[model samples]
Target: MCACPAQKLCTCSASSLKKTSNHRKQKRLFRKAFFFLQRLTRGNQTDTFRGLLLKSTCSFMKNSIFSLILLFSAALTGFAQDTIVLNNGDVLSGEILEQTASHVYFKSAAFGSISINPRDIAEIRFTQDQLGEITVPKDAIAKNEAKPPNLPASKKPEKAAAKPPQKDTSKKTKKKKQWSGQAGLAIALRNKTTSNLSGVYKDEKYETYRLYGNLNWKGERNSLRWDWTYRYSEDEYKIRDDFFNITQKYNRSFKNKNLYATAKTLYQRDYNRRIENEYLQTAELGIKWFGKDSRVKLSTSAGGGYHIYDRLDSSRSNKTSVSLPKFIFDENFSWKILSAQELEIIQKYTHLGNLDDYHLVFSFGVQNKLVRELFLRVEYKIDKDTEVFYDDKGYYDKALLTSLVYKF
Candidate 1:
């Protein structure tokens, strides 16, 4: 098994021998590269090159190889791509989607569609693939500039021939309608205990929940919308109150004018107020200030409507139906305080045939964006009625509520 001399033995296995062979091959390749570089420099710099190559470690070779690979990749990327060189020495290589005097639309793999201002760009370069030709060297271009190439008669540039007018091929498109709406819920819960001088103990649990929503559709000249609110509350003993109201409105703006016409209808039911059913229909001529998309908006209208309702007797034993003509005044204001926040206030007053029989309702609300199509809403509302059939003191209610809202 021993092929070497007396005390010396070969410790090489098959793997070790393969590794040794690889090391020798690498040394030969390194020597060839060193000699090539030495010949290429071939001057006083030859000694510097030789010293650096011979004294460098394997890691240095690896880093140099990696840098060369990166440079080659960059060169290949620049060959068939469009480029934009920014004034701050930033470079982008991608396909140019469009170019205009003011802006350039470019698409890149790293970034999606991008809009770049022309002023921010220092230069632009496009590929010659579109023309199916390659560029020549600077020396050849300079020679051509010095002496124009001779051309035959047909090859010379000629004045463009006048062409007939082209027919219009584009079709007219209708304006698209925009739709938006929101839905929300507000709820409250409470627990209470009461004791009398007679030691009569009473405990009650109260809870209230309200659900509301609105839907709106807007077109070029016409818009339609509807709103609904439902509230129900109860104590341990029995249901305290149940209320519901819904209104639908249709509006049309006059062409080339700020005036608009509105038609609205409302239906309501309230168990606490002894309102069996109520219906109102109103037509109004209104005026709107500012554009529809403006940050601030104000609108007001005055109208007359027919109101019909049935009310229960004071004993809650009999129902009486009555219809009357009423007057109405409505005003609305909205402000966009921030890109993601909005505030709105609305006031409405109704007057029956008797001056003493009237009601006023005021509502204020704010919506803050939480995420896409979702919001946090805070609302304050007041309802005051000067006349009542079952109670001596007029009805008055106020509430401060918060809810989570979703828009679509």
Candidate 2:
């Protein structure tokens, strides 16, 4: 166990330091006294024993200083004592448990049951339980602080005078931040309805299977989002790591009555490392909002983007003739039909400068949250394109999806 720097030191630990310090003090005093005697009688005590004792004393001091320096350095860079001070002075020293808005729980003591809170609490404390007289705040004290049972009622101030107005701390509300994330697998099967949309190619089936993982850190005034996705083709090996992407999104709620939007950007120095290619950068901006939070369309954002895909993997590759710039947009929505299910939709468009090819995609999905932290999803999607796609681009034979989803 380490000393808790937050509170006072323990007596045993302090005693150890005191003992080592006294030893050093005795050594220093002895050396000082010897030096004083030498100064008092100049040129006296030039004996071998006296010289040996001085050398030994000096060597021991040098070694002690070095040892102390090493010990301090080792502990300094190591994990130092940490503490989390809560507003109400209740200290929690380990990971906390959380379920939803209705209740929250935390481990306030070791091998102790978690305390559930119906009322919103201030922040949670995270620290090691160091040994000392922990300072429990006034709020955690007994309710009758001003009254002493032994006091005479007549001697005490008249009831009203004894009760000084308590400070109005009603506005002091503290809410600890919560962590949230989603883990779901998206299973999509695409079919083509119109062959002319793909032009040269007929209805072909392609699968776009994606697993999305996100972690959201909730905070006052703002929140941070980390998203990572892994997508692949179920039938054909069409795209490589090109199907993967990562993004950081910042979210906030403003006072605006009916406006909300999510703007994002992406950057990658190398699309393919084994085979060098031009740097890739994407910039998207859009805003789509709702009339109200309960309006089914939890949130909607419409943003335009500029994308640049430089050199292709091979110099002779015709996919990207030169550095390209294009437009991009996305829209997302959610509708709750049942406590166990939600309906979702998304639409996006992309254009490239090289061949003037345009792409548009629309998708509808249903998600069922069957258990705590588990979900199932199904979706249908369509793609409209002017240029011919080799194997992966065009929509499935009918531009629709039929598949089973299992999420963890």
Who wins the TM-score comparison?
A: 1
Overall local distance difference test of candidate 2: 0.49
TM-score of each: 0.51, 0.41
For model 2, residues 171-190, the per-residue Cα lDDT tens digits are 77785647877776666555
lDDT of 1 by residue, 109-157 (tens): 7875676665567677777434333233232221112222222211222
Error of 1 at 178 (Å): 3.0
Question: Model 1 scores what on Cα lDDT?
Answer: 0.70
Model 2, C-alpha of 161: deviation from truth (Å): 19
Per model, state how many residue pairs clash: 0, 15
Best by lDDT: 1
lDDT of 1 at 348: 37
Off by over 4 Å in 2: 1-177, 192-203, 206-209, 234-242, 267-295, 298-304, 311-327, 340-357, 383-408
